[model samples]
Target: MKYKKTILATTILSALLILIALGVSLVVSPMVERKAEQLLTRYAARVGAIERCSFSRVEFSPLSRSLTLHDVLVIYRSPKGLRKSMDRLEISVPLRAAACAVPSLRPYVLPENGSMDVCNSITADGVSFSMPGLLAGSLKHAAISGVSADARHVRAILDGRRPEPVDLLEHAVIDGLDAVNLRATVQTGTGSAACTLGAFRLRGLHDLGIEEIRFEQLNAATNKERAGIALFGMDGFRAPDAATLRLLLSVRLDGKKSPQALDKDIEHVLPMLQQWLTATIPPVRVLAVEKASFRGSRPQDVMSLDLMRLDWLSNRPREMKTAVKDLVLPAQLVESNGLHLPGLKELRFNGESDTRDEDGRIRETGYLSLARFGQLRYNASYAVPGGVFNFSLMQLLSMTIHDAAFSFVDQGALAYIALNQHDPDMAGPYFNQALDYSFPGRDNDALRAALKVFTDRPGTLDIVKTTSEPTPLLRCFDVATLGRLWRVSATPGKESLYDQMRRLAPAR
Candidate 1:
């Protein structure tokens, strides 16, 4: 009888312990998740908005010193009416200071843990972007595996629909640099009916201190106007001081917009775009397109002339690129700032240029062979006391056999404008249109006069012929007789632009 009673009592005690443990867990789970929601929502508030910061469950293992949040959901409202979502976030924060956060200039309240870094590992089962359409686009199995201050492994499988017919995330990797491949099947979206790229891969490096970023792209596009780019690659870097970039893209556009339309906007939008570039201070480097079968305006026209209002590159300008008859290739931008325009040190694309290469032929096939290759080089200097600005432009034509043809000159232009307070942000140290031809025979008449007016001090130029100049290639138009020919070529339009031109002319 005594043994049986003892056994019964022990059984009752064990049952009681089990019930108590279950009750504690049931209560603590809510408390833990609630606290997590508060903390996460707080963070989102500091950074941006989170429509709802919640998780299906939260588990804390005291012995393991770990916190796991299950079925987490995060929603963000971008300014342009876009909603970004991250769902099924399984973040395991090992309470033992698993990793230290990289200190940021942005004010962030750190946890009691000594380090100022984010939690150790952040994993999300799915993340997506959506328009009002209810289903936008997403990535599956996105994660930051070995996250730390210096480096982390980021991987994501892209399988999502853009607001378009069917957009796709081809692939993505976020490591020292973040790379993403996006495929869009849309006629147009977001920006004022911009042309959308069929697919593109974007790689970016971020500035730890600010919202600065450097980007590169491997892109392909198909536009509504029956225009396309087979392959386009661009790479650029931006820092506080200066920037450099290159372009080697192949493009096809349609009937270009008349030059009158382009000429009007070029003056305003041209510098506006360059200003847009300079707005990002420190240093900037970019690589642009090289070849094209353009039916209409060049990409520079859309960037510098048409789409001047929106954010640069960020608004997905590549998608906005369309073949339209709005602007010209090698259009001229009169330097607004006579000598003080000092910022644009070097800017050249698809123009005569000089660069060192043994064969001059580009190894890449199916690209524009302007020569062995095209060359553009520029350098400028300023003297505070002498008030003089020296600038140089050099070009090399691929039309010449091997290394036989080249045209280069260095000229020192004196700053005509006083250190005046009101100087329209200048294009600086450059005649925007180098007046050289892609197929040789570019007129240097007006360009020479403009050079004389703004860039040349008359006696300061040192014209040197490094290689044989093809006679027809560097031909100068007889500006002295252009007025007589203008009667035929410069017919007045509905706005009577020819009349306006005569109005601005001297009383000859």
Candidate 2:
């Protein structure tokens, strides 16, 4: 009987202790919530210079060291006023400080006693920002993971609807943000379009592996015009200088100006652009694109490009190369302009230029080749006394031409052009007669021979300037005639462009 009584008494005492614990929880939770709210209000008031901030509710968990806010809003009034709001914001701070204390020494020592995660997570849901004449952006959800100061992981889904139908990112994951891929939808006046940014890696301000940037209309039937970049990439990217960045940002962010005033505003910025070009500009190693295309509703509106590339191989002596291949233009469009030549497939261009200081003169040498149904190659060199070039017309005219040569290879285009003329059968003889009558000199005879050879049987013909003296560009065009200055010489070329470039840039 005594043991049973003792057990009952002990049970009553346990029930009383449970009641006390419940009372403490109810009282402490409200107090913690109020304190969190007060702290947030104080912070907002203290740093409310650029923006006014407020929240409707605050929830805090002391054990987990996590805090959540509901109905957070911020209003900014710079250049033009804008508003931002979020449905909920949650931040989970680490329960222990050891993990974040020495973030740089990661993957070695972890938080003691497994007290906290390696990263503190902060999340925002239903975030939206809007400004007139600019953009309206929203985030369905976004999260930052890893150390709070330096996040190692981030993920988000962002959408934009102003300026264009820009659905910025359907989903994105930035693992240390080393590499990222983004896809978006762009709304056009005619129809909707989709854009994709291929995988790219980032280190500090440098970027690499920018595999592609593509755009294409979603519904071609409903669109009046369609355009796309099938592939695009660049290497050796350096971020612009701080001042340039600030200038660019100010122009975009200062939204006080109206659309009508934009052109004038840009005009005022051109002088500053000159400084931008010469200051803190680093060369991009390589930029390439494959298969950029465009099409309009009309059949004559089609255009396609197979490849385009630019290389800044060297900056010391300023060596550069550029190429354009298989650029197609609609034959119908050409015919509409009253040209009779048909069956033209594509146009191509390859060029290389080098500038260097030799002795006391600045020498520039380059070769340009253009090909459509036929091919034409021009190689030239110019020299000028070592001095700053002010880019004036007089300065350009004063430069001396050291050497120049032009070459042509027939690929059936000459025959088509001759056949389309009146009196096709006698076209060759007539052209020869005209050449003789128009030019009468020793150099003229050489040109005549080259032309006759080409007419007899379509073949390669070369013309080179014999002038060894430095001739000013103005005198070359105005005083000296081409027939008197240049001579025809036979130099055959059958090498493909790929082989030609390989020879030109042996280091590559």
Q: Please name the candidate that would achieve the greatest lDDT relative to the true structure.
A: 2
* Candidate 2 residue spans exceeding 4 A from truth: 1-191, 194-203, 206-225, 235-272, 278-285, 298-301, 313-316, 336-338, 345-372, 384-395, 416-423, 455-457, 478-484, 490-508
* Full-model lDDT for every candidate: 0.33, 0.56
Residue 351 Cα positional deviation in candidate 1, in Å, after optimal superposition? 7.8
Can you give the TM-score per candidate against the true fold?
0.34, 0.55
The model with the greatest TM-score is 2
Q: Which stretches of candidate 1 lie over 4 Å from their true place?
A: 1-35, 41-48, 58-81, 90-125, 133-135, 140-223, 226-236, 241-508
Residue 433 of model 1 has an lDDT of 40
Per-residue C-alpha lDDT of model 1 across residues 1-508, encoded as one tens digit per residue: 9999999999999999888877877776667656666655665665544554556666664333346666556555554345554555555554323222212411233342222223444555455565553335555544453232211211011111122111111111222322233333332454222233333343443331112232223232444223434344444444321111111011112337566755654544444444434352312233333233333233333211111111123211111111212122222232433333233222232222222222322111111112111222332111111111111122222122211211222121122221122222232223224322221233444434434333322222222222332222223224543322212111111322122222223231
Candidate 2 lDDT by residue in tens digits, 169-278: 11122222222233344455555554444433332221211222222221222246666676666655443444444454557536778876766656655545544332
For model 2, what is the error of residue 407's alpha carbon versus the real structure, in angstroms, after optimal superposition?
2.8
